[model samples]
Target chain A: MDVRVDRDRCIGAGMCALTAPEIFDQDEDEGLVVLLNTRPPQERRAAVRIAAGACPAAVITLTEQDTSTAP
Target chain B: MQHEPSLTEPVTLPTQRAAGCPFDPPAGLAELREQRPLTRMTYPDGHVGWLATGYPAVRAILGDPRFSSRYELLHYPFPGGPEGPLPPAPVGDMTGMDAPEHTRYRRLLMGKFTVRRMRQLTDRVEEITAEHLDALEHRGPGADLVKAFARPIPALVICELLGVPYADRDRFQGHADTIMSMDAPPEEGYAAMAALQEYMAHLVAAKRADPSDDLLGDLACDSDLTDEELIGIGAFLLAAGLDTTANMIAHGTFALLTNPAQAEALRTDPDLAPRAVEELMRYLTVAPTTVRSALEDVEVEGQMIKAGESVTISLEAANRDRERFPDPDVLDLHRKATGHLGFGHGIHQCLGQQLARVELMVALPALLGRFPTLRLDVPADEVPLRTNMNIYGVHRLPVTWDED
Candidate 1:
């Protein structure tokens, strides 16, 4: 899985970071999204997807690769 | 020559919620959203600007920073539009300020309000809710829920978080109420503000002298925020935290009592409190309308809003648009209430939202659990509504419960 966050657009409500801290963290000084893991193992992908979906600003996006989506 | 548009019509803001349906948005808003998604609105000051009831338009406007939140720059939407561009929001009041400035204060405070930190307070919230519920139960079969339960939880929680002495809460809440009141006497309100300022100034100084682990203390220890900024931030949090949540609890209880089926649903399944809270927030948008001014020429949904022109995004209206949420009028506890703008949205979304959510999540379930047969002491019509205030809610929720 791959993830991206728009720092400029992030108002830093902190929902993303709080939900999936492994994948996302915030700049304490700026309260902006710090995309920690651009790509993560399959185990973390599901949680990251939930985090992305839950973001209030819709700043987080994830793309799943073929192997990642493999059943 | 401009062609005449037959479909579009003028509409003024702040139409009244239909009688006996205090939980729903104005009936006219539903009609307006259908007839004219966007309309030419004339403010009381006679400044003609756009008024939006459509969901998409409101989302675009609130999410875009170009639509400045600077209160002074925008044409005020309420009764009397204050003449002249207002002064910038006070040093620490980040709500009315734009980015960079807003970024500074919001960033400093973000450390305190993180979702994890807020969730950690769930146990504390439960304790507080239990304490209030115990007192309410002990009082009698009939009592004012607002004074007995709704008002105390948020007030105490905020005071504890900000390190403001809880002993001073009554004085502090009084001043905060004055500042929030739309119809209060100007001189009286000004005096309350001054008193609150003086009170906060002393508290800030004490924190500076001896900082602690609380939010205000943490800031006082690390940051170089001046006393005024600290006071302003404290005051801002106090006003925001106290009013919105208090009303939600008070009015939310009223809403549930009137709709017993919904209350029973919550009582039977306590887990439903979270979604029920969201539905209540959407159904009763306490912070009715927010104003924004275009910083540059922007085309939104085919309408060109020129720079300096302002628009009012009626959240009450937007949240109820049937296109977005089917049968938006109905309060469904099990409904997927995510993405609702109960806490508003975008960069300027509510800061203390997680805390607010946790409090409501804990308070509502506990209240219902403690008093299964809870109900309104007064008739629905006699239950006073806060129509005059900027925040829509009840003046008092008179409630009763089975003594046995």
Candidate 2:
């Protein structure tokens, strides 16, 4: 899955960083979101999804990977 | 269209918080919530709406996009003879707006409130907290905590944020206080509202002419937001940031004094102050209720709420729901009070929350630490509650401490 934070829309509620700290970190200066790992491992998907859903500014967007031809 | 008064008769809004236990939601409301979470409610304006009193319903309704938040859409339920929704919240007041328009403003202003910025703000908030504590100390034992400390901390923080000239604070803060109040006369409130708008217009213009490092100045030069929009946004933010946090500090202190066990916990751990703030928010539920209109036909829990119908969510009742929190009335600083809607929920949840949280975490503990003997000057019941106003708090919290 592709993950991203729209720095423009991020309110820095820190819900994303708090929920999935490994993949999502907040910038110290502005407190805007910092995406540490865009495609985190599958085991971490639930926390990532919850983080995106919980963002007040709704900045996090996750796009599903097209795996139609996966071996 | 009365529908023959199902289950129980329509209950009014602003039900008195039970006499002795001023913190609890009105006993009548708890009974109503128990009978059925949702029920028909009539507004002062003669409009009938749905009132959601349960935890699940209140929380869900706030987050659900199907509910409209536009100011004019929902009928105000407060006792002041429900008039039109406060003359259409100025152009950029996102609280009255829905998607797209709200999205625009929220996106533009979100960066300024990031947790990183707010935490880094710890130094500034601490400085402000210390200044107020010093003023309180110098003034000695008896002081209206509300006036001397609680109100000024957030008021000054907001003023500095917008770069409002220090000279203009006396005039603007008075106008703002009148405007935010639920008890102010219509004539006075409207006049103050207009004056505040004019003052903000001039301030915004000044920022445009000479942009400074402040939020308003940065917004002036950075965004394509119009002057009027900027003025509206400035007032919106100022009003939002000031009263909410101020009331929390004053009321939270009162709560801690009355519930010394919780205060003692904070005194011992100090680290518990952050969690204590959230617990206080949930326990007090300061901004008790909110209005939203259903944009389309929808069935919530079993009832079919038709389009254009308004719903008043009783946040106080919801926060105190026993299902959500065991012994909901108790003020336990250690309770993991996450998911509480004190800062509200969903798309329109408070934008200034991080700032408010930081202020509470700083002010509450510092005040407690500064004066270990801090206690109320008057009988607990005589603290002069701000029941008439929209924001719930003490009009004047008279408190004193033993001199060292």
Candidate 3:
């Protein structure tokens, strides 16, 4: 899964960091989204999805690969 | 010919909940959500606008930039609210302002309240909670939890965070009570607000002269926020942080006392505290409603919101929406209540949420653990509710515990 965050849109509610700490963190200076990992492992998918959905500003975006086609 | 009810006919916002159902949102709100998530509504000012009742609709309106939070653009939803268009939000009062201005203040404040920073405050929160519990135990057998326990924990924490002396808590708390009370006359509310602002101004000046290790002190020293803005922000934070969490703690305790099984579930399993906090927040959404005005003509949920039309988003109703939360009325601690609108949504979401969460996570379990035999002193139905205020909570949660 590819992960992304829009710092411009991020209001720093920290929902992403709290929900998916492995994949996201808030920048110390401004409390904006800081993408910690661009591609998290498959095991972290559910958490990443939850984080994306939970973001009040809709700052987090995830691109999930179709597992059905994968070996 | 029978006169058919028009879609534009405004429905007054419901204030009365089902009798004896203290935890529920106002009666008719859920039915309104079921019928139409967004509907024409009449404000207390007699301004016809829209009310968003469903989870999805309220969320959409809050997240959409086209919906303005500007105070001047919106109509008051409650009676005795300021007549005519209100003045623009004061400097640093981000709740009533739109972007750019709101953005700048929010950014400056956000770093102070990041998830990590709040987590770091957990130990402190635990200490504060324990201290309050100690006091409550000393004063009880029977006491008003709202006064002795609920109000003090958050007040002291917020004071410590902002570098305000806890010695001044009674003064500020009195001011906050007056300003937030719907029953207070307009002049009294204004006077209370002015006095609080004056107090904050003095504090801000002190911070500027000698920087301290706290939220306001840091901002005063490090940021370009003017004294006026700092004062506004300080006063705003004090008012914001105090009553909301205090109510949640008091009302949440009230909730647990009434629901013995749920209370037992949490009391036995300390690990359930985190989830219990979220569930309680969802179940008893204290800051019940927020308002937004349309910045421009926009389509929302098949309705066209014309420019400047105000919409009141019922956070309480939204959190209880059956489509979003299954068995919405239940107080189950184990439920996944993450996406609830308890702290609100969008750009102006509560900045102090993480801190509030930390406080609740520490305070609730600690209170229960400290007083395992805690129960309501007054009958559940007899407890006075804060129905008149914009924030929903119990006025005085009279509680008792078994004395050693």
Q: Pick the candidate with the highest lDDT.
A: 3
Which one wins on DockQ?
A: 3
Residue A43's lDDT in candidate 1: 83
Worst 10 residues of 2 chain B by lDDT: B81-90
Candidates by lDDT, descending order: 3, 2, 1
Sequence-dependent TM-score of model 3: 0.96
Deviation in Å, model 3, residue A41 alpha carbon? 1.4
lDDT of 3 by residue, B328-386 (tens): 99999999999999999999989999988998888888888899999888779999999
Tell me the deviation in Å of residue B132 in model 2: 1.7
The reply for model 1, stretches above 4 Å from the true place, is: A7-9, A17-54, A64-71, B1-6, B185-191
What's model 2's lDDT at A46?
83
Q: Give per-residue CA lDDT, model 2, range A1-71, as digits (tens).
A: 77888886555567777568888987765566899988877778888987876676567899878444322
Residue A22 C-alpha lDDT in model 1: 84
Model 1 chain B weakest lDDT span, ten residues long: B79-88
Task: Report per-prediction Cα RMSD to one decimal.
Answer: 3.2, 4.1, 1.9
Q: What is the lDDT for B222 in model 3?
A: 90
Better of 1 and 3 by TM-score: 3
- Structural similarity to truth (TM-score) of each candidate: 0.92, 0.90, 0.96
| Candidate 1 global CA lDDT score | 0.81
Taking the tens digit of each residue's C-alpha lDDT, what string does model 2 give over B1-404? Answer: 56655685666664777677868876778877787888888787777778999888887788778988897787878777347554556687898888878878877787788666777789998999999899889888999999999998998888887787756777788887887787776778878877888889988989999999999999999999999999989888887777899999999999999988788789878789777877998998888878899999978878888998889988888888899989998889999676677877777878888788889999999999999999999999888988777778888999999999
lDDT tens per residue, model 1, B1-404: 99875665556785677888888777788877887877778776777888988888888888887889897777766774356454567667898988888877877887677666787899888898898887777777889999988888998899889888889887788888887887775456667777888888888999999997788998898887888999989888888888889999998888888888888999999778767877887887798888888999999999888898889889988888888888888887777666667778776889988788888898988888888888888889999989878788999988888898
